[model samples]
Target: MSDLVAEHRTRSSDWRSRPVTWLVGTGFALAVLSLVGVGLLVVRADRAGQPAFAFLQWNLFLAWIPFVLATCLAAVHHRRGPRPLLWALGGAWLLFLPNAPYILTDFIHLGRRDGAPLWFDAALIGTFAATGLILGLASLLIVHHVVEARSGRVVGWVVAVGSLVLSALGVYLGRFPRFNSWDVITDPNGLIAVVLERLADPLGNPFLLRFGLLMSVLLLGCYLVAWVLGRGILGPLNGRVTR
Candidate 1:
């Protein structure tokens, strides 16, 4: 265990001490990866007749470029935080919960645009929201951990604040009705009487379920994958465990 740990540190040290050229090169590479993810998600969803929101949500949520860059910074910097990791893991679990209803629905061919039991529909919307809220919290933690691990204290704080602001904005948009969204955001299920309708439709509003499955997949699918990758891969890349 000691030797394994030593080897890990060596790699971390090597990367941190590498030339500026390597750092810049790697940053560019990660940027390309980010672009590819966004582009691919968009192209695939569009081809599937999905809404632009799918592409927007996936690309916006994945945030791979910033994630990888922050990981690299964390590796070369402080590299220690208990709360950040806890927030991330816990948030990931919450984000995953929303999918339960979807899973049950699909399992029994009950997840539909038509309608179902009052309780069931409420569960579905609740879960979808839970998933988003959890992921947003997770993103904030991931950013915090990565930035805190890095050297630029001011930059790190900026990143953290920016993440919080973004999450807040997302919640606002999700909850508040928009004047521009009159054509969208209808109510299919209204048990809570508190959940604002969405500004986009999956099967009822503008486009019939021509791609409900695809749209749902785009939102939930990319979100889960990004969450896992950010926490698992990017988190550890910081390469530091303070003693």
Candidate 2:
């Protein structure tokens, strides 16, 4: 256990010392900037005496929930906690994880609004969605690394693929059924009933299945692309000389 703790710290420290540190810092800065842009849009709407689409701010906040939970799981890994506890933390993280990327679905809400240019509204939603995706991806990699440390790399990859699939289902539920993460705790029986019904007649709910599959593919592709780009950007830290 002590060895595990030491190893976790060593890796974390190494990450902080490497060029990856700068990249992560810049990513976080951009996310913040995106939020700031959203705020500006809200203010602009208010100045124009228009509905601000304030729900977007709330959606962005919901997106942060999973990211924060994943960060907690990462911190727990460094503590070398019991396996059961760690798994529980990971499960909770997974439950809320879909919320992070769910913002992308908000684009469906985009329409012509009085006093707001359509293009500006589009840009605002796009920024929030992008920031939400970044948060999800960063948190996912954090938890993935923790899994990799304890299990094999193959298991880590398996977990990543499985997570993307499950997250897609989660997003569908949130977007259509209007289910929230807290509903799992507050209305477990009802939620379970709905889930069972859907599973029992998967063909009956073709739209749900198709939506989940499509989202899973989209998220998987984004994660892989970003991961490759991150590696490329941090090639120096990986000890490869890049021209």
The collision pairs in model 1 are: 75-238
The C-alpha stretches of model 2 lying farther than 4 A from their native spots are: 1-16, 19-27, 231-243
Each prediction's RMSD over C-alphas, in Å, is 14.2, 6.6
Question: What is the Å distance of residue 87 in model 1 from its true position?
Answer: 23
Error of 2 at 170 (Å): 0.6
How displaced is residue 25 in candidate 1, in Å? 28
Error of 1 at 74 (Å): 8.8
**TM-scores for every predicted model:** 0.30, 0.83
Query: Scored by CA lDDT, what does every candidate get?
Result: 0.40, 0.77
Error of 2 at 205 (Å): 1.5
Model 2: ten consecutive residues of lowest lDDT: 234-243
lDDT of 2: 0.77
Model 2 quality (TM-score)? 0.83
